[model samples]
Target: MAAYLKARIDLGTLEAGNKLPPTAALMKQFDLSDNAVYRGIALLKAEGYVHSQQGKGVFVSDRRRLIAGANRIKGITSPGESIHHKLSARVEAPDWVAADLGEGECVNRVRTVNRGDFILQASQSWVHLDVAEVVPEVDEPQACDPTWQAIYEQRSGNPVGVASKTVDARITSAADREALGLDADFAVLVMRSVYVTGDKVIGVGEGVYAPGHPLAIA
Candidate 1:
């Protein structure tokens, strides 16, 4: 179905910047099952051929997918996409976070990447007290902007010195599934990162990306 649609798009049968046929319509026309139709559409999206806009349906796109490296994973946003973040206000640090950054009250950050109403990726991170002290932006109560590493450098004048990332596939947690709007407990690509600046370990974060997501590599 993806190949067929690509061919149609190539031939101008499905013009660029036009909405694709509705899922039901595509299912009928291609004689494919519902899952098959969605899978085909997902493939098109991963390849930068299309994007889903929640209630607006899928549309053909001529833009390239945003490419990110391991360091830029949490900041990946395609052209014209929106990002929503939630920052917990002065919460007790989680045990695991304390294990890494010592015992103290810390802030939790959840960043959701969206296109129209469709969610693309979800990243949840905890801020260390030192980082929060250096960068007050982390302490904002209603932070809705997905943050990149450079924010720290720009705000604190401390460059990101060394970084480490652990990438794996894991069963989706209930929280992540809800955030990503998945109907089932599918496996997701996960990346946990730690950033060190000078002699201080500034921050650590985890990013949850959909399998085969175009920007998942970062």
Candidate 2:
């Protein structure tokens, strides 16, 4: 099945660009019927793990692309890697943002995250301005510092409990095209997340990622 093949792929047993076993061989090895084997192959193809040719066998897809996930609230960056970013403060909270953080009570920080020369994601984080006394960094640009959730927890004296996210795809705008090195036709992934500590919404973030960047949720 797809799970078996994925495990092999993840373990390096089935390398990228390597052709999968023929239909009969796969069916025999897995004790699967023709339909079951094809279904499993179809699932893998749809998941971007493999591709099939008309008469040829299926081959694994390349997995070198960077993956961004919904659970990564702190943003993506390697250990000791400085995240290149441009940070700005928004004076007026957008209507939807205000609804999440109380009307006229939210202070917003927009961060455009980049890796080297390529822009990876653009994130807008909102927190109540009242907490500025405890988390003064929220008003300043952060090159590399504690995460928003950490600051909120420090001020509120409550541990973050859960994070909820919604993911969608949309066509890139002119600004996104230039910042993310993408064409107008390409689509980007947008993930909106709300970090919560008990019943309190500690922070809200909207992150937009460029196309071809894989996303894994765990």
Candidate 3:
């Protein structure tokens, strides 16, 4: 039963935000008992294929995917896609962040990337205080110009030569779940990136993408 439903979702017979038929209807169609039908739904939910809304129904989750290059120099944004960044104040780097950017040598800048009403990802960037001061806009919340590489080059005159990224699966945090409207217990893809020029780590960016949004190699 779960296999049948998964095939439907994969083929887009059932699309994102499309509610699944009621339990009785599914039970009738699949010749399943009430418990059997629910168990199948539970499996789909655990696999991030669907989400249940209180008083509404279970619906297919969005499978909108994005691609990130192996050596991506910029933040991932599709062409002409409007991304708004809510930049946070420069603060002392966290332990993990300091480890990457060097303790006491880094300042933190955070942003929430959004496209229209949909929240795409939340990013926290760590850069040297001097670089942050030079860019200035890193501290200002505003719409990004397609990519961060462009902004950084224009502001700092330093082009990113190479970037390395690592992707992992993790449970969503309370704040990220609220910001991205993620379903309960859904896992998110965490991409940690390091932008470099020569041997210097110019910036470190960590982005959390909601479930159903897989990252492909660009």
- The estimated TM-scores of all candidates read 0.56, 0.57, 0.54
Model 1 stretches with alpha carbons more than 4 Å out: 1-75, 141-151, 154-156, 215-218
Give the number of the best model, judged by lDDT: 1
Which candidate, 2 or 3, would have the higher TM-score against the true structure? 2
Q: Would you list the C-alpha lDDT of every candidate in the order shown?
A: 0.67, 0.66, 0.66
RMSD of each: 13.1, 12.3, 14.6
Give the alpha carbon lDDT tens digit for every residue of 91-177 in model 1: 676776666656777777777877787777787777777777766767774442324345666667776733566668899989888
Q: Which residue pairs clash within candidate 1?
A: none
TM-score of structure candidate 2 = 0.57
- Pick the winner on lDDT between candidates 2 and 3: 3
The true-versus-predicted C-alpha distance at residue 204 of model 3, in Å, is 0.6
Candidate 3 ranges beyond 4 A from true positions: 1-81, 105-107, 143-157
Per-residue alpha-carbon lDDT of model 3 for 111-141, expressed as tens digits? 6656676677777777766666666655655
lDDT leaderboard ranking: 1, 3, 2
Please write out the lDDT profile of model 2 over residues 2-98, one tens digit for every residue: 8778756643456568999999999899999999999999988876678887788799875433122222322234333235445647466678766
lDDT of 3: 0.66
TM-score of 1: 0.56
* Alpha carbon lDDT at 11, candidate 1: 30
